[model samples]
Target: MSNPYFQFKQFTVWHDQCAMKVGTDGVLLGAWASVERARRILDIGTGTGLVALMLAQRSLPDAKIVALEIDEAAAGQARENVARSPWQERIEVVQADFKKYRSSDKFDVIVSNPPYFVDSLECPDRQRAAARHNDSLTYEELLEGVNRLLAADGLFTVVIPTDVVDRVKAIASMNKLYAIRQLNVITKPGGIPKRTLIAFSFSNRECVIEELLTELARHQYSEEYIALTREYYLNM
Candidate 1:
C-alpha cells in the first residue's frame, strides 16, 4: 500500500484526503521552479500542499505564498499540513477555484501541475478523475486566471506531458505568456522525454530548452535528479 503521508526533511504531507498523492511530477516542478528572488508566490491546485511547502523552503524567510486548491477536503488537509510546518505563518492554504479566486496582490511567480488529460478516459473515482482530467480545469481557464494575478514581469511555470507542451504553449501565448526555458525530462538515459518543465513570462525572448534524465538505468536514480531534489526526498 502507498504510504498515507510523505515525509520530507522539512515537513510531512498527509495525502489521505487528496485525490493526487505525492508524485514525481509535483516534486520535479517544485524543485526545478526558479524562485530565488520571489517575494510572493502562488501554487494552483496545491493538492497535499507539496509545491507550496517546497517553495517556502526555497524562498527567503519573509516570502509569503498562497496555495489554492478547489477541493475543499484537500485544501483543509493542505492547511493542516502547513500549520504543522516550520513556515506555516509564511504560507496560507485557500480553498477556492483558481479561476474564481480573487487577489489584489500580484505574484512574482506562479506554478502548477495542472490537469492535462483532455482526451483520456475518465477514472472510476470521481475525485481522481477531477484531479487528472482537464474537465475540472481547462488550460484556457488556467492561463486566464494566471494572467489575471501574475505580474507583468512575473514567471509562470508548469509541468506537462511532452506531447501536450505545444498545445499548452499555444494557449499560454494566447493569454500573453511566453516560454523562456524548458527542461525535458526523460525516464531513462535513452528514452524520449516524458514530461517538460516549462517556464514562461510576459516578456518574450529566445526560448531555451534543456534535458533532465531521471534515471541512469532501471531503478537507479540519475545524478541530475538527485541533485535537483536532494533537499526534499529523505532517501535522495
Candidate 2:
C-alpha cells in the first residue's frame, strides 16, 4: 500500500507501515468525540494518528492532545501524520501501551477505537492481528486505564462492534463509568447495526440513545452522517 492511503481536508495519514489503516470507525470516533470545551484529550490505540488529528482540528486551538499506540511502526506513522498537521504543537504521539503509560494530569476527554475482536478467528499477520484482537489490550485493562486517566467530569468515547456494547458497558459499570450517550451505526435503512459509538462518563445519568444510519443504501451517504462528518471529510 502507498504511504497515504487516506486523505482528509487538512491532513493526510500515512498508513503504509501501520497494521491498521485509516478507516471510517476512526473517523467517526475522531469527529464524534466531544472536544468543543475540552482542553486536554487522550486517544488510545491511535493507529495512524487519525483520531488525534481530527480532535486537533475540531477542538480549541490550545487543546493538548496525546495519542498512545503500542506498535512502534504504527506509532512512527502517527508521529509523521501529527507533525504534518497544523496543530502539530498541540498534539503528541506516544509510543507506549495504554496499560503501562502513566500521567499525572487527567484528560478532559479520552477516546479510543480499541481492539475488540475477542475470541474471534485470528488473522495471519501478527501485528495486524494484535491491533485488531484483545491479546495485547483486554477490555478490563482498557476500562481500568480510562478510569485512572479520566478526570471527574471527563467523558470517554469509543467505537465498538454492537455485539460487544453490552459486555463493554458491564465492564465500564464495574469501574463506575456510565454511558451518557450512544449512537448505533447502520450501513443502510434496514441493515443490521455494524458499530456502536458510545460516550461514557463518571457521573451516572440517563443514557441517551441515538440510532444513526450512515447511508440509505450502498454508496449513498445519509444527510445526518454527512452533517456529523462534514468538518473532516473532504467530499462530504
| TM-scores of all predicted structures | 0.98, 0.97
TM-score of 1: 0.98
Tens-digit lDDT track of model 1 for 34-92: 99788999999999999999999989889999999999889999999999999999999
> What range of 10 consecutive residues in model 1 has the weakest lDDT sum?
114-123
For model 2, how does the per-residue alpha-carbon lDDT over 10-85 read when each residue is reduced to its tens digit? Answer: 9888898899888889988987878868999999999899999999987988999998999999998899988888
Candidate 2 whole-model C-alpha lDDT, 0 to 1: 0.91
> Worst lDDT window (10 residues) for model 2?
1-10
The parts of candidate 1 lying over 4 Å away from their true place are: none
Runs in model 2 lying further than 4 Å from the true structure: 1-3
- Please estimate how well model 1 matches the true structure, expressed as its whole-model Cα lDDT: 0.93
Error at 223, model 1, angstroms: 0.8
